[model samples]
Target: MCSNLQKAMIDLIEVFHSYSGKEGDKYKLSKEELKTLLQNELSGLMAESKDPAVVDKIMTDLDENQDGEVDFQEFVVLVAAVVVACHTFFEDLDKGNVTPCSRS
Candidate 1:
């Protein structure tokens, strides 16, 4: 069996492809695909998705090349960022620095 970390890496690749290639660029994620991926996969982590501009902002920020799409490398950046944020959130909660139930 693969190690837990290997499984996580595979899962990330699967999740990325699962949302990409609907319209164009089979290897990249368009804006709509990115939004769907976030809404579907990160719904709980991204409660602010209610804001329509959230996706727009994400796309703009992740599209470092300004090509209007996110390639695998770019997608990895987003995943890493989210993972880091989650780590920080949990770490803070553990130290009593953040309250999960607190309103943002």
Candidate 2:
């Protein structure tokens, strides 16, 4: 059986491919694809954001090459960032520096 971390890596790749190539390049995520992925797969995370420009902001940030689309490398950067953020949150919670309800 695959290890938990291995499974997570596989799942992440699958999720990215599942959203990419719907509108354009088969290997990259256009703005719409990224938006759809966030709304559908990450609804809880996206829901907490009240910014109307969040998607645009994310797209701009992730498109590191400024090619107008997010390729797999760029996509991984976003995933890493999120993972780091979650790690930090849990670390803070464990240290009693944060509360579950106050993680804003």
lDDT for model 2 comes to 0.94
In TM-score terms, candidate 1 sits at: 0.90
Model 2 vs. true fold: TM: 0.91
Residue range with the least summed lDDT across 10 consecutive positions in model 1? 43-52
- Residue-by-residue lDDT tens digits, candidate 2, 37-92: 99998788899999999999999999989999999999999999998998998999
Model 1, CA-based lDDT = 0.90
1-104 per-residue lDDT for model 1 (tens digits) = 99999999999999999988997998999999998898789888668556769889989999999999999999999989988998999999999998987557
TM-score for all models, in order of appearance: 0.90, 0.91
Stretches > 4 Å off in candidate 1: 102-104
Clashes of each: 0, 0
Residue 12 miss distance in model 1 (angstroms): 0.2
